[model samples]
Target: MKIAIIGTRGIPNHYGGFEQITEQLATGLVERGHSVTVYNSHNHPNVAKSWKGVSIQHCYDPEHMLGTAGQFVYDLNCIRHARKNNFDVWLFMGYTSSSVWHSFFPKNSIIVSNMDGMEWKRTKYAKTVQRFLKYAEKLAVKHSHFHIADSPAIKDYLDKKYSVNAKFIPYGAVLPAASEEETLRQYNLAKDDYFLLIARMEPENNVEMILDGFSASNCKKNFLVIGKTENKFGKRLVGKYGSDNRIKFLGAIFDQETVHALRANAQLYFHGHSVGGTNPSLLEAMASGSLIAAHDNIFNKAVLGNDAFYFDCAACVKALLEKTVCTETKKTFTRNNTEKIRQQYSWDKIIDAYENYFFECCQSAKNESYVSSKRWACK
Candidate 1:
């Protein structure tokens, strides 16, 4: 099958979850003997025509200059390109900006949209923006041939709200080995010496709350906040807790190997994301055998299950830390989480699921095309 993947920054994945998933999915599909083309942003640092056997097509993205509005134009450009490509399927990763053009999607290709977290419910967006997002989501649901929800909770919500049957297929990750001692030394980090929080310093991520709770804790380990500190929320977090020498705000480390190393050695990995389903970072932390203290939400609960320590507020973070400093020393959670990743969330199984879905959709599409042709001939 010839598949065209859209709605991501690029393949080499200097961006977030969608891009990472696209990189994995596209490359994996290509390796499985399918022709896959991943649409990229022209703004992406790497401008290669192809990366690891997957074809690349760059579209103009002015997010750096126009901000959120630029994404709409970028998606338009991708849609234009996709319409001309005549691919068997178009896999759109998200609906944030692309849903508005849903009606313009190529008629020959079966459109599959991945329903990412409840974007409208995110706390950061304004009321008007949230309403617009809801409308866009509706359009996506109505126009797409199939809905892919990364979490069961998301699938259930979409099914109830739209009265549509959406497929539930969570994101995937590879189980990581132990951290390299040399990699740990580069950051002056040691095995289990620090608690880590790796996420964009956004308000929705509960970044400030995590820092506040850590500051409140009497625990001995350092709290390392990974991700960029240049944003307003990040800078505000620094101003509020920067003086607390215990909190180390190690800004965005993009290298996957480095991130896996950090996760492997962390005493505790705090996943405070409240917006998304099956977060890539959370899976990475689990794969690396990190003991997790995730925000208690249906999304995280579904992924971590009983293997993680849950927290709802600053007090909860403080309590979890205090416990970890003492009796929470057992490696049972880490062992169980790693096993979960190995058994359930491996990328190999995820790619197979996608392959099976693709072929099913393709065969259904062919039958529909045949029926449509017959109707036209009779008319």
Candidate 2:
């Protein structure tokens, strides 16, 4: 099948979750004998025409200059280019910027969209922007021929809200071979000596709340925050906690090996994302065998189940920080999480699921086309 993947910065994964997943999925599909093309922002670091057997299509992206509005232009560029390709399947990774141009999608292609998290619920956006996102979500559902939900909770919501059977296909992670202790030396950290939190520093991510809880706690261990701090919320967090010698704000670190090492060695990993589906970071932490303390919400609970600790408020985070758990219990939790990744969220399994689903969608499209032609003949 000829597949075109849109709605991400690009393949070699210089950015975040969607790009990483797209890189993996596109390469995987190509390896399985399908022709796959991934749309990349012209500003993306990787300028190559192909990477690991997957084709790359670069489009103009002006987000650096025009800010968020530039994303619409980039999507339009990608969609316009895609219309001429005659792809069998067009997989849209998200609906936020591209759904508004649904009318321009190729008439003959099967449209399959991976509806990302509930964007309207995010506190980062203004009320008007949230309303626009809600409208965009509805438009995506109304126009797409098929849908995918990364979390079961999201699938349930889409099914109830739009009366569509959205497929549940969560993100996948690669299990680390072993902990790279050397990676920790650069940060001046030793094994299990620090508590780690890695997030976008957004309000909904609860970075401030976690830091507040950590600061209020009596634990003597250092707290490491990993993410870009140039944003308004991040600057506020730095100002509020920068004076604390124990609280270190390490800017965004994209090296997967270093990140995995940090997660594997941390005394505890805090996941505060309350707005998204199966988060890539959470899965990586699990795959790295990190003992997690996720925000108490359906999305996190659906992934962690009974394996990790949960926190709702600052007080809950404080209590968890101060509480002592036996080594046996910690081992049990980390073991369960790692096993979950190995069994359920491995990259190979996710790739197979997507491959099979694409085949199914293509077959259904063919059947519908045949039936329509037969009815026309009868007429």
Candidate 3:
């Protein structure tokens, strides 16, 4: 099937969850003898002309004020391309941007939209943007032939808020590259020596809270946070926390091997995302066999299982620190849970799920298009 994937920064996946999923899924589909084209942002310098047997269509847009509007501009360009491509299916990865394209595409086109978290609820957007997002989200849900929710929490949110039925498919992760010894040596630390936090340093991710909590912790272990220096929030975080050598802030790590090594060998993985569905980083850490200490959200709990430790604030940190080695039963449970994640959340399982969804949407589209054409001919 000819598939067009829309709504992301672009193909090489230097950035976020959607891009990573797009890269892996596109490659996997290509290997399975499906023709896939990923719409990429020309603004991203590292994006190649082509990638992994998939065509990368570069969509150009001016950098206006830099944020949601910029995204909309890029997405509009992608939609223009999507309308021209005549793809068997258009798989939209984001909520706010792709829904607007529904009016442009064939109504019978296999439109599958991923209801990626509640974008309106995110703290980053302004009141006007939030209002627009709420509308776009509604249209995306209302128009799509199929909807994908990355976690049960997201699926439930859509069901409750939008009264829309969405299929739940969790994100997958690859294992880390760094060996236990090498991982420890690279960081110049023993196992469990540092509290590691991996996330985009955005307000929604609770970056400040993570830093403050670690600083407030009387625990012996140092804190190591990894993320991209994206905006003012990141700058402020660096200014506040980066000065402390103990609070090592590694910014924007692109090398997967290095990231995996750090994640896999960390004494503990600190997941600070207060919002969003099944985080790819947290899942990757689990796949890497890191002892998980995540924010106690439903999404995190659902992913980590009851075996993992959860904390909301400084007091929670004190409890987590005190219970570290004493919770051998918890460790054992988490280890077993890791094995489960490795099996269930593997790339193979995820790719297969995507393939099935694609084909199903494509076939449905074909049937509906045929019926529409027949009616037009009769008229």
Give the best candidate by TM-score.
Answer: 2
**TM-score of every model?**
0.95, 0.97, 0.90
lDDT of 1 by residue, 1-379 (tens): 8899999988898979999889889999989898899999998988999999999999999988998999999999999988887687789999999999976787667889998999999887899999999999999998888889999899999999999888888889987655478789898988888899999988889988888898998887788889998877788888999688989988888887888998888888899999878899999999887888899899999988888888889998988888734334447788788888888889988898888887776666666661122211100
On the 0 to 100 scale, the lDDT of residue 9 in model 2 is 97
| Highest lDDT against the true fold, candidate | 2
Report the C-alpha lDDT of model 2 over 1-379, residue by residue, as the tens digit: 8899999999788879999899899999888888899999999989999999999999999999999999999999999999998688889999999999988987778889999999999999999999999999999998898899999999999999999999999999999888577887888889989999999989999998999999999999999999999989999999999788889998999989999999999999999999979999999999999999999999999999999999989999999999887899999999999999999999889999998888777777767761122111000
Residue 259 local lDDT, model 2 = 93
| Candidate 3, residue 119: how far the Cα is off, in Å | 1.3
User: How far out, in Å, is residue 83 in model 2?
Assistant: 0.7
Give the C-alpha miss distance for residue 20 in model 2, angstroms.
1.2
User: What lDDT score goes with residue 221 in model 2?
Assistant: 95
**Scored by CA lDDT, what does every candidate get?**
0.86, 0.91, 0.77
| lDDT winner between candidates 1 and 3 | 1
TM-score of 1: 0.95
Error (Å) of candidate 1 at residue 46 is: 1.4
